[model samples]
Target: MQSQDVAPRPTPASDPVVDVEQAEAALVEHYPRLVRIAYLVLPPGLGRGRRVMTAHALAQRALPRGRAASPVIPAQANGRDGDPGYAFVRLRVLRAALEAGGKRRGLPKRSQLPPLLPQVWGLKLFPRSGGADELALDQQLSALSGPARAAYVLRGLEKLPDGDVRRILTEAGAADADAALRAADRVPARYELLSSPEFDACSLQARPTDLMRRRQHTKAALAAAVAIAVCGALVALPGDGWGPDGAAAPVYAQNPAAEAALDPGRLVRVTGTAWESAARTDFSAWPARGDLVDDDGLLRRALAVWARPGEKVRLSFTPGTQTGGPAGPPQLLYAGTVDNARVVILYDGLRIARYAEPKDGTAGAALDFARVDGASGAEAAAIVLDRADGNVRYLTAPWVKKAAERDLMKPGAGAMDLTVTDGITSPLASPATRAGACTSWNVLQLTDDTGTHVLSDLGELVPARLTTGRPAKEKDATGSQALHAWAPYACSLGAVRSQGVRSVNAWQFAEQELPDGSGTGDWACTRAETWRGDGSRTLAQFHTPGGAYGAVVAKAEGGPACGPRDPHVLAGVLWKSEGGHWYLLAAGSRDTASIRATGGISGSAQGHVLAVRAKEGAQAELEGTLEDGRSISGLR
Candidate 1:
């Protein structure tokens, strides 16, 4: 279980030690977030010196396994940058800190646990100026046990859903995710401190303000002007979608009432200035935006999406028909949520073949730079992202390599023209334009079974250069899937080729060395009644000497999987830990179903070593031994 320091590598390019450098960089980038989480979990009462050192050590120990458990933070959360990945790792590190000692027992008694304050978590939801004393907060928190402390901090402060909180507590060495949830719910009136308004209710209905939009940005005026588009009367496009009399009308939502229903599944149209957003630096408070990319490349912006708790929103991206152009083949058209700050990105990996068939080394019409035939080729494109940063600045192509020059609006008013090619008419513009006024185009076009609807301010989609490789596999029709939304054992995650067998995302280990030579052993204990029920399931996650964890599940109520009641064997759980998280040493779950039959259960992970303990309910019972000579079963 001992860790050996890696030998130093001088240079990344000269030495070419990519793996080592990458690992080191990941640890560095995530260290701060990890420390913050560790501090929350570390038992209080230690001086500053011990508290800081312990959290850092725990974070370091967790780095490797953390990486293994979840290699990539899923791009679906639309959270602040790296929040998902760090959130995943934070739980593991906290759990390791809780289960550090050789001895495992009841939730740290109030007398044994560290100080915690409800206000610390409350500020995350609603900030105020009370500034409660550290000592007073500590005294208030001292009344709570370790599990309660964890629940208050994680579920209450982090704003994670109840389910996510439970999963984290379970992995942190709680007897089970559900039992941990119950214990957390036992925290008196804690939920009231974190309550906010209408968080869970979502309405796609268009309100009056939804029809209003910010007006033209003038060089002379520092601030933006607000304007409302006339909706009562519709004006016909001069050349298209007009009646014979050349009359046009403003379009309205096909079913505004359907959206007003406030159902989770119905699609709501977003247009004009209907929705407002905010920005935050760290993914913690107001956790929010992506930087704008110009001809000069990506530039950091002091802005982001500011979403309130329980407000779940997804941007719509539906690609149109492919007209063979002289542009590079499309590699990826992704609605980004990670790394790039949750912006839409389309990477064209220069796949020339995906365009229409070519002729004489030219993509023929697809690449016809000189287009008279309305053909297709590798055409240039642009994106316009509007962030609510006091000013209305859009994320668009940086023509002339100058971010400032990507001005979406010229003085006066006119549609912002996106010139696809030098002489070609701007590819994406409003159907009509004022002689001197700016014509703004809404980029998102939503096509449902009923009809096609347009969303304003989502950003315009045009061709762009894509250098990165496309996703290895396309996302399923169901939409962005959670990396670990369901327990890896509960259901499959995606078309991830590496899914199912063992979850290898990110993890870190806390090694606990076992006595030498006595590696193999048997537990000597009596068998308890093998009571069965669908009432609840008890699962135990055991930590390896190296800080990695493996789990075992028993479909019974009010009983521990490992303790002193029934000597339960890990019938289908894995017995090995790799890269800091438990891995299946062999095909145990997929093996014969008879392995868990009513008779004596088979198998053991005794060699890895475990310190399983139980927290008694209000009515404490005699902790009993199991048939296994060494294993114990009870509530953890």
Candidate 2:
């Protein structure tokens, strides 16, 4: 999904979007779940760009909808006076998602949508726990067309009113939620909604048609902003990371297929640890975008894009001997890879956690192959494995099954394919499409000798600009920058982990620049850094771990630390990753040409920089600062 907004939406209904303060309050407490809802509502087939745009746009639109049910209170309405802020925020988000996903064509400019066919494998439901409320809302609803799924999630999972659900679905371009539900067909049996006594009274009256809807929802955009807290987490790794167990280490262990290393050719291996890859940790980044705001109108972690607390997945791997060797970090390494395994991942509620690849070539090496919440804490996760042969495998945690999947303790439905890249598939190529649209969402569910498994059909997960928002202390009703985001389409997994394949060899051998056709090649790299004031004595580094690379130059000057003990008054860096090593074709730095700050001493330099002008995937570690008192570091 290319990231582009639908022409600004007409704010319909009363103002569901509260003043900045209230919107921010809702964002702090419930934004993550709201994002999850938005994710559910987006059709996965959208490119990362499109998915991101639609989700954010929907959120923008949602903030002001269904508000006829509620109006603004005077000043203290930002939940300061005990307003039902959570309910207000969620309804808007749900409305936005439904509307966004309901688009049958791409953007209006897209003219004709390729089609809405998603690939599916019957194995879909991902129930975190065996309990009743443990719904794999995403997976279940994902298999259905966006409109239908939106209906069920709102009415069934969130328990929204029948009227709201009907209006939401219709506004999203569907005839009605019931009709979308019928299109899914499997949902009724999966949720047993039609026969369940619990839903006996959900008889909703149909709203007017979409044409009439357009007439009703014409209004202005929501007013909100996202402010970011730069000092503690953004400027550098969490303060803890700068000191102890918080640093991002490769945790590299030998690939169990050590023998394959001798075989040459492409001996691919998949490995990682808990809550690490395919997840977001730089919460401090993205705030400058002012996309998602909280009650204080600051940019913040909008939501848990992947794992939430408690959602654990226990991964099963081969048992091997333990030996320790120091590569990046030293630990017990696994001996060999597990074979013909029946790995059962477990989940609790919808929060996914736990899940590890038992071995890494060296034995006793219990490394968390991949994680949802970054390093520690359990959260949601989806697994993918790369066979030495070229194809990929998707696995559902023991408890996490697709939504439409029937029969819990048995193989439900699942599917597999090697063509789709970056979790996206165009309907034009799928036989599942109908007329220029899809008759249904196309995520495949598959059942195998190993229980039910789901190949990652990223085609269904909608990507969006993720951030949290809060109002600024100084009330400015007119200050929210309409939120926006961009989708950097991935051509390949490259140095990055498969979003589906939770784990991959940290260093793909010589994937980094190595001793090749090189003469200190052009310095190439993508980067991020920070700085203080006075004489710009600085620090800087380059990043190329994900394969993004380029030759780069840096310079800085300083003044005084903004405040006492605040060594960094001003700091900033920009860089991107690459499939090949980055090259610092040339480089230089200087603090002599500096200035003075608070104590007459130049401000301290605190920035990072790097260069990978190598041919093979290898580069010695380089770390330093830039001109004008900035601190910089390299990210692997």
Top candidate on TM-score is 2
The whole-model lDDT of each prediction reads 0.28, 0.28
TM-score of each: 0.22, 0.27
RMSD of each: 29.1, 28.5
Q: What is the lDDT of candidate 1?
A: 0.28
lDDT of 2 by residue, 499-531 (tens): 212211100001123223332222211111111
TM-score of 2: 0.27
Which portions of model 1 miss their true places by more than 4 Å?
Answer: 1-26, 65-84, 101-130, 176-636
Candidate 2, which segments miss by more than 4 Å at Cα?
A: 1-17, 47-57, 60-91, 103-140, 161-164, 167-174, 181-185, 188-636
Residue 208 displacement in candidate 1 (angstroms): 63
Total clashes for model 2: 177
What overall lDDT, based on C-alpha atoms, would model 2 receive against the true structure?
A: 0.28
